[model samples]
Target: MTRFLARRTAMLVATMLVASFAIYGALYVSPGSPLSALTGNRPLPPEAKAQLEARYHLNEPFLVRYWHWLVSALHGDLGESIPLHENVSTLIGQRVGVTAGLVLLTSVIIVIAGVGLGILGALGKGLVDNGVLLASTVSAALPSFAAAVVLQFVVAVKLGWLPALGTGHGFADSLRHLLLPALALAATSVALVTRVTRAAVREETGREHVQTAVSRGLPWPSVVRRHVLRNAAIPITTVVGITIASLIALSAVVETAFGLNGLGAYLVQAAQNKDVAVVQGISLVLVLAFVLTNMLVDIAYAVLDPRLTLGGRAA
Candidate 1:
């Protein structure tokens, strides 16, 4: 178990390195210089341009600039934001929690609604299952942002059931505002969870252990509860873990639609304004969060299923 975990950890490190390199390289090569963005179409004097370039190390060789940025970023220095003139760290810190809260709420919805539906659909396996499968398919097809618009219009504007936007305030009022947006954000994720859980449950139901338990005169509910659901959840658990990691930079469009001030919103604003320092800091933090979340998810596998750890079985 320890060896397997160690090996997976090594692989994860390699993956992160490759991903970071790609992210950094792409950021550097992306068109439109921050200088141009800062100064706009008006041409700056040579001396002014030189000073600006020197301040941000734009005068350095590309590799040198990248390496310097990497090192400085490691020490919590993301250079100066040409536009905002504020510390990148502070800007990102101010916004990250909002996104974290949204993700948390979305995860709860996905787990509860998704898994609950999976269990129900799996137990019935006919009209109920088919209907859920169709709905899940639709949810999966729609992007979060588009879904947010649809939900906002139908639920908030048309139905007048919930508030249309914003976060923070009276718990009930804020929650009402959050409901549609969170559902929109979570819809695809819930679809994923439902599909995974349903497939797992379906497969587990046909396993020899399940048949044997059934043949022993156990109630179907008892058999499913005791034997199938836990084993079935293993694969779903993996995807759910991955989904959480994937949320760090996701939900920007949702934020825009619903007027939520989140990390995703800040990222879009930073990129649009060419706030280089803020962009770099936010990107680095997002990548690190994903890497750390993935690591935690991997560690959680062994905890969830004994078969994958401590010599129970090779997976």
Candidate 2:
């Protein structure tokens, strides 16, 4: 177990380092100069252009600049934001809290609604099962942006129950502001989870152990709780783990629509302003988050099924 954990930890670090390097390279080669954002349509003098290039190290070779950025990043210095003129790390630290809140709340809602509906629907086929299927299909068809617009209109604009946009003050206020966007962000994921869970549960129910439990005269509830759900959890866990990336993508649209000052919003803003430092820093953080979430899910697999080793050996 110690060896397994150490190996996973090493892989995590290496993966994050590679992801960071790729992000920096991508941003370096991306079209549109920060100078365009700086000077706009105004023509710049040769000296001014040279000064800008020198300041940003644009005059350096790609590999040289990349190495410098990577070294500084390893030392915990993400550098200054070109557009915002603030430390990139500081900006990310401030905004990541908001994105975390949104993701957490949305994840909770998705797990409960999706897993609950899936389990209940799988217990026996009837109207409930059909309804769950229909709902999941419909929800999955709606894009995040469209869902956010509809939610904002219904819950905030028309009903006037919640704030339509902006991050309000305090925890309670922030939750209210996040609800609409989070719901929109969670919709597709909930559908995905529901489908994955339902399929897993249904498959587990038909396994030989489930039949054996029934033949032993075990109660239906016990059979489901001890046999079906336990075995079904593996696939469901995979789906939930993989959904983190989708959630990140949706959060960008949701944040834009709701005007929340989260990491997603900051990324969009940075891209528009061609803020390379902010973009690279935020992208690296997001990739690390994705990697960490999958690592946790791998640990979760062992908890869910002790007989299955995370290192691929059967316990």
Candidate 3:
């Protein structure tokens, strides 16, 4: 276990490094120089441009800048936000909790709704199963933004059941504001998890072990709980992990739609302003999150099924 964890940690570090480089390179390669965004309509003098470049180390080679940025980032210095003129770390610190809360709540909802529906569908062979499958299919086909808009209109705007914009103050208030956006963000994940779970459990239900349990005169529910769901846990766990990881990216759309000042909203603004520092910082953070989540999922596999070995042949 120790060796496996060490190896996976090394891989995570490498993955994060590669992701950071890709984010930095992609930004540099995109249209419009960072300088252009800074200057806006006003044309800067040659000296002014040179000064700005030197200050931000933009005049240095890409490798040199990236290395410097990486080192600084490792030391918890994410540099300054070009547009906001705030420390990148400080900016993220303020808003990350809100985003984390939103994602956490959404993930809970996904696991409950998706896994519950999937299990119910798997156990029922007729209308219940078909209804769950149909719902999952329709949800899977629906675009996230369209779902967000519809929810925003029907739940927030028309019914006035919840706040349509901005994260409210305090825990209770925040929950009220975050509920709709979290649901919208979780729609696709719920559908994906539901489908994955239902399929996995259904496959397990027909296995010889399940039949043996039934032949032993075990109740259907007992058979399902002890045999079917246990055997299906691996794939279901994988889908749940993927769903949670994707929520970080999806928060961009949901946050924007709801006017939440989270990392996603900050990312969108940074991209629009061509704020390279903020963009790079936030992108790296998200990448690290994604990598960490996957690593946790890998670790979870061994926990979910002890017979399965990590980084070696299964037991």
Instruction: Compute each candidate's TM-score over C-alphas.
Output: 0.88, 0.94, 0.94
lDDT string for model 2 (1-315, tens) is 666677779989999878887998888788978788778858899999999899989999988988899899888889888767789999999999889999988988889988988897787578989999999999899888999989988888899999889988999999998898888998889999999999999999999989999999999999999999989989998898888655774688899899999999889889988988999989988888888888888778777876667546522
Cα misplacement distance, residue 142 of candidate 1 (Å):
3.2
Error of 2 at 130 (Å): 1.0
Q: List the candidate numbers ranked by lDDT, top first.
A: 3, 2, 1
Kindly report which residue stretches of model 3 are placed more than 4 angstroms away from their true locations once superposed.
310-315
lDDT of each: 0.80, 0.87, 0.88
Best by lDDT: 3
Which is superior by TM-score, 1 or 2?
2
lDDT tens readout by residue for model 1, 138-241: 98998898898899889888998887888867767667766777788888888888888888888999999999999999998899988999788778788888
**Which ten residues in a row are the worst by lDDT in model 2?**
306-315
